[model samples]
Target: MPIQKVTRDEILQKALGVFKRQGYHRTTMDDLARACGLLKGSFYYYFDSKETLMKEVLWWVNRTSEQRIFSVAYQHELPPDERLGLFLDRLYAAVLVSEGGCIMGNTVLETAMITDEFKEPMLVFFTNWTNAVAHIYETAYPTAQALKLAQQLAAEIEGSLLLVKLGSPESLLRDCRERAINRLNVPMHDCTSNP
Candidate 1:
């Protein structure tokens, strides 16, 4: 058989799992290569360094979140309650409830102090997340209050995810979700309803 070509996205997808499980510092290039079914040398062809690969992984995650989670906040036809619930549900499914916890959170704790490059993408992720939640909250409150509530909700969910990672009951996440919906003060309805 001839040598197979690996796309950048394929490498990043495999690398993300390994990085999430083993963390940025603990994961070696060789480990990422194995995860992608490539030799160590081939891994270098895709990324000049682990940091470069990790940055792209963060970008990929941000793009995925924009599509699946943040977009719900922009659906003006949906009630705020339903939109918030859907966004939270999609978020939990995508990134929060994983055994490895939130990749952005994990990366922040590991690499925030060491490099500006890593921190920039992580900051963008949180800013985008906060803005999305704020947009939903704006349905009920003034711009200032809505932004405050959005920040609080974002922090609360992150804290809840940390608790889950530390062996707290997963219900903690569910409770956070309920509290967010209630805080928005919009009546709960079927998120799937046409709006």
Candidate 2:
């Protein structure tokens, strides 16, 4: 018999969905394996343990955000407001906001206190996100104020995502997007505009 070859990327893609939907503690190796279309034993060929796989997943999430989400913040060709809008749009699409809540947010809430391994990656992910928003806010306000507003935007978005999960309304994300743009005094425009 031949051992099946699975790329790390393939495993992470499927594992991310499982973790996002089922969370860390509740998700088993079998669950991740099944998500990857591998048997439990075969899963070990790719990862030593769930924690190792999860750490890789977090790294994968961070890399994806850097490439797709955070990169929008650095688009100097776009106006700050447009950059911010595009950033939110990319974030919504990347997280598949309609299907499952933010994976990083869910993972942090589920594992922040219990797992030391997740701490640094979570912090790095959030700090980068905050800085990206803050850079946009800085265009209109002082540095300290910009950072404060950025932090507020981050919190509001996370809370809005929670609201979405609570059956409040799908429009909650749009409302948050509007509030963020309004709070920053950015001209009202379609956040869904392509970057």
Candidate 3:
């Protein structure tokens, strides 16, 4: 009998969970197959190799995150900082809590040493995201300055997410953000007002 199309989505979703937990280099095709309740041969039928599955999973993660952040950034009802904060909060919840970290960050950390192909997409995602952040900062700062600050903030946030995965307490991240918020001179009252 032909299996349902939903089964493939289920397998991919489960594979994503395993990949998120064990990371790209650490996870084997067997691991993903087991997580998806499929035999290794069956898994191979759906995905040619572990790398192919990983690339698709990482792309899904990036696409979902981009949509969420873009939704907040483009929404007219919310101010820039408020929208950014909402996005960040979603980020913290999505990547930081037990799932360990962002899939792009995880992919970069593990495969960056091994392959250029993996790093390319991660770079593009960061470039676009950092540009969006810079645009938001432009509401308060000069364009050039905002772009510089956005790069710095993007680096800081990515590093902080890595640290969170490494088991540093959340307060350390919050402290870093507080210091950054001060340095950016974004009014604190605005966060409370919009939230």
Q: Report the number of the highest-lDDT candidate.
A: 1
RMSD of 1: 5.5
Q: After superposition, how far is residue 46 of candidate 2 from its true place, in Å?
A: 1.0
TM-score of each: 0.90, 0.90, 0.82
* lDDT per model vs. reference: 0.84, 0.83, 0.71
Who is ahead in TM-score, 1 or 3?
A: 1
Ranking by lDDT: 1, 2, 3
For model 2, residues 128-164, the per-residue Cα lDDT tens digits are 9999888887776767767877888888888888887
Q: What is the lDDT of residue 15 in candidate 3?
A: 76
Question: Comparing 2 and 3 by TM-score, which wins?
Answer: 2
Native-referenced Cα lDDT, model 2: 0.83
For candidate 1, list the clashing residue pairs, or say none: none
lDDT for 32 in candidate 2 is: 87
Residues 1-195 of candidate 3: C-alpha lDDT, one tens digit per residue: 333344766776677778778888789988887777677777778889887777777666667667876456566587765766775676677676557567777778788988986776688777777777777677767677777877887778878877776788778667655654454455544433321
Candidate 1 residues 1-195, lDDT tens each? 233578988887778888888999999998988888887887788899998899999999999899979999999999989999999999998764445878998898888888778888899999999899989977777677678878888888888888888899989889989988877764234222221
Candidate 3 structure, TM-score to reference? 0.82
Off by over 4 Å in 1: 1-4, 186-195
Winner on lDDT between 2 and 3 is 2
